[model samples]
Target: MITTRVVKILYVLALIPISLFSLLMAVYGLAWIDDSAAFGYLLLLASPFVWLFQVFATRIVLEFVINQFKISEYLRAIKDKG
Candidate 1:
């Protein structure tokens, strides 16, 4: 759950580009902006894959942090002691 929380946070953080591009898309759709449509569409198409990569990447990073920070060891110790 903890790792998942971290992953969710990181995943949401990773969505910044998508959100920004969504806003840009909205603007383009409304004809308030014209020059950014292609770029917006590019990001729109790429963002899901990018976020998927971010989720996996965040998991890897969190796994490293758990080991490097000894959080998993502490958890195991607690479970054993209990």
Candidate 2:
């Protein structure tokens, strides 16, 4: 369990570069179609928003998993008490 937690943290950290690349690709695609330098510039400027979205998504997922784990633990404890 400890190792799994460590690996998950590392995996999430490793996604930083992947998110940056995705943001760049998105900006490039927008530039290709819209041909608006401003759009590309704005997308680049909002790169942090993309990262923030990823972080929020990751946090939500982890929170859900943790809540599930805690619920299961509580149920087991209740069963044991009974």
Number of the top-ranking candidate, with TM-score as the measure: 2
- Model 2 lDDT vs. the true structure? 0.71
Across 11-58, the per-residue lDDT of candidate 2 in tens digits comes to 578587758776786767577556777767667666677777777777
State the number of backbone clashes in model 2: 0
Segments of candidate 1 deviating more than 4 angstroms: 1-36, 69-82
lDDT of 1 at 73: 69
Clash-forming residue pairs, model 1: none
The local distance difference test score of model 1 is 0.63
lDDT of each: 0.63, 0.71
Query: 3-65 in candidate 1: lDDT tens per residue?
Result: 657756766786676556655555554452255676656655655566567567666776676
In order of listing, the candidates' clash counts read 0, 0
Could you report the Cα RMSD, in angstroms, for every candidate shown? 6.0, 3.9
RMSD (Cα, Å) of candidate 2?
A: 3.9
